[model samples]
Target: MQVSGTFLAFAVLSLLTIGGAVFMISFTRVVHMVISLGVTFLSIAGLFVLLEAEFVAISQILVYSGAISILMLFGIMLTKHDAKDEGVSKANKGWLSILVVAVFFVIAFWGIQSTPWVAPPDNAAAVQEDNATQLGVEIFTRFVIPFELTSVLLLVALVGAIILAKKEEDNE
Candidate 1:
C-alpha cells in the first residue's frame, strides 16, 4: 500500500528535527551548533504546517528560525572563546550527570504517561480566521504589561551582554 503524503512528510520532518537536535548537542563549534538549532526550528515549523497551524508555523519560522537563530549566532560571536578549544565541553562527573538525566527522563515520562490529556476539538477553520486578531488584541490589551516588561528584560540582557563582551584591560 502507498503511504499518504501527510504521514510521509511528518515522518521526514520528525527525523530531521531529531537529527538536528542530536547534531546541535554533539557539535563542538558554537556556530555549527547554532546552525543545527536553526535546522531543528525549521523542521518544527514544517511540522506545524502539517498540523494545519499556519499562524503557528509562520511564527515558528519568523521568531525561531529567523530571529532567535540570528540572536544565538550573534551571542556566540559576541562572547570571547579560545579557537584552540575544539573539543566539546564535558562534565567532570559524567556518570553522575548521565544518572541525573536518566532519572529526570524517567520522572518526565511518568508524568506524561499519568497525565489526563484532552485533545482540542478539530475546528481548525474557525480558529484560523480570527486567530491573528485575537492574539494581537490579547497581547496588546490583556498582556500588555508582561509584554512591555519582557521588552525591558531583553534590553537589560542585551546591555549586560555588551558589558561582558568588553575586555577589562582594553577598557582601561
Candidate 2:
C-alpha cells in the first residue's frame, strides 16, 4: 500500500527500457537504432543493479552497452545496405507491425495477470550477497568451455567483419 524509492526507481528504469526499445524499433536509420539499443541495454543494466545483481549489471553495461553497440556500429559502417525498397510499402509495413505488437502485448498482459505472485524469502539478501561468487564458480567449473567458445566466436566475427571491410575497400 506504500510506494517505496526502490519501486519508483524500478518504474523509471522500466519505462526507460521500454521507451528505448520502442525507439529502436521505430527508428529508420541504423545508427539511431543502435543508439536506442544502447540506451535499452543501459536501462536493463540499471534494472539489474536495482535487483542487487551488481556483477551482472556491470557485465551488461560492458558487454551490451559498450562492446556490442560499438561492434554493431562498426559492422554497419563497414557493410553496404544501399539497396532500394522492393517490397511492401511503409504504410502496410507499419500497420502489420502494429498488429503484431498488439497481439504480443495482449498475450503478455494476460500471462502477467494470470500468474500468482509471491513474496521473496527473508534469506534472499543472504543469497544475493554470494551471487557473484556463485556465478563465477559456475562459469569456471561448469560453463567454462561454452564461455571460451563464445569469446572465440566473437573473435571470429570481428575478423570476418574486418575481412569484408577490406574487400570492400579493395573493390572501391
**Candidate number of the best lDDT:** 2
User: Which lDDT value does model 2 have at 58?
Assistant: 95
lDDT of each: 0.85, 0.87
Question: Which segments of candidate 2 are over 4 A away from where they belong?
Answer: 79-90, 155-172
- Tens-place lDDT per residue, model 1, 11-40, is 999999999999987787778888899999
Q: In lDDT terms, how accurate is model 2?
A: 0.87
Residue pairs with backbone atoms closer than 3 Å in model 2 (clashes) = none
Pick the TM-score winner: 2
Worst 10 residues of 2 by lDDT: 80-89
lDDT of 2 by residue, 131-165 (tens): 78988998999999999999999899889977865
Which residue segments of model 1 deviate by more than 4 Å? Answer: 1-4, 75-92, 122-125, 166-172
Q: TM-score for each prediction?
A: 0.72, 0.76
